[model samples]
Target: VKIRVGNGRVKGVDLGYKVIECEKIVVAAGEGSKYLFQTLDIDIPIVIRRKELYVSEPYSLFIDPLIIDTREDSLGLYVTQTLRGELMGSIDYPEAIDDLTHETTLKHYTVYAKKLVRLIPIMKYSTVMRCWSGNYVTTPDNSHIMGRDPEWPEGLYISTGFSGHGFMLAPYTGFLMARHLIYGETPNTMEPYTPDRFRMGKYVRESLVIG
Candidate 1:
């Protein structure tokens, strides 16, 4: 896949089989944004890290609110019970890798098991039904990248690098993005996330990112 730019503006996207024509384009590809941005021959401060999660067999409802462990020993551990009574959560992997592989390791599972048992002793008996891995598209400051820039293709915009808060912030981000695209006005809420901030050496530091 590639983005087509002509006369210093977004013309459309090349989807291998056909070109979808459009004047305005938003790149919200999450971890895949790096590849898409390469189509435009531009670079941004984005990194991809691997995260692993597991879901346990259903138990009687007990936990209500999401539990987060931010202690020095468990910096990225979080556990929450699903509506269906299944326990699900993950501990963030400390290392960052350049590749985009979704491979989960037994070491992660063992470590998580130990930590979860320590936090909720009853959880030691809960069987892990499944495990999975995913990518955390992150920025230098751990905040999302939003809005567009005048230097690039005129109609090209960006909205990625959520680190781990994409699902939580998607609705609000989309609303502000729509208003900006339609009325050509940058909402105050989005002012801090402009792609230009990286160029200006201004980073938005967010300390609340959890696993």
Candidate 2:
């Protein structure tokens, strides 16, 4: 659903321009962040990409937490072990998706399933069961937008453009952002992802380990 935004006030009293009635706002808007910043009128140049994942299993199971490989430009399959010793896998494809449906692709399963099975060395004889897609947002440098707005410390704040790595790092990002919101200060660790870096031509590319 779409949330209608207006001048932040009610009963003829302006509550500091933003009516959220809080000291700060951390915008972890996910894929919708592409349109979310329009509310504040900041051009944070990013794109929303649709992505797909796959699930499958053999009669037996193997493996651990999600696995990824940057070379495929798609999600490397992750194997999950079931109680009955069957295997389930999830894939993160890199191809741009056009819609939000979790549709499965045959070619994707055909290519990634076998590789996942091979990684564990026990599924060379198994077949894939399912696959799906979802939405993702990314930026040119793969860094996140953090820190207080220089001109609007009291006006607004946002945190988006996670690319695809936010899920794994959100726990700490949340703690760090929450501290910034409540205390108005963040450590030097988060200083690199200033919101205005893109506009000022000051951007740092993230390490390729998790790309």
TM-score of each: 0.94, 0.69
Predicted candidate 2, C-alpha RMSD: 5.2
Residue-level error in angstroms, candidate 1, position 114: 1.0
Clashes (backbone N, CA, C under 3 Å), per candidate, total 0, 3
TM-score of 1: 0.94
- Give the C-alpha miss distance for residue 95 in model 2, angstroms: 1.8
lDDT of 1 at 33: 90
lDDT of 2 by residue, 1-211 (tens): 2223335411121235543343344556776665655645556677666665544554643455545543453455555666755565555544654355556677766666656755666566666566556665667787777765565434356677777777777888888888887787778878778777776788888754232
Per-residue CA lDDT of model 1 for 160-188, tens digit only, reads 99988998999999999999999988878
Candidate 1's clash total is: 0
Residue pairs whose backbone atoms clash in candidate 1: none
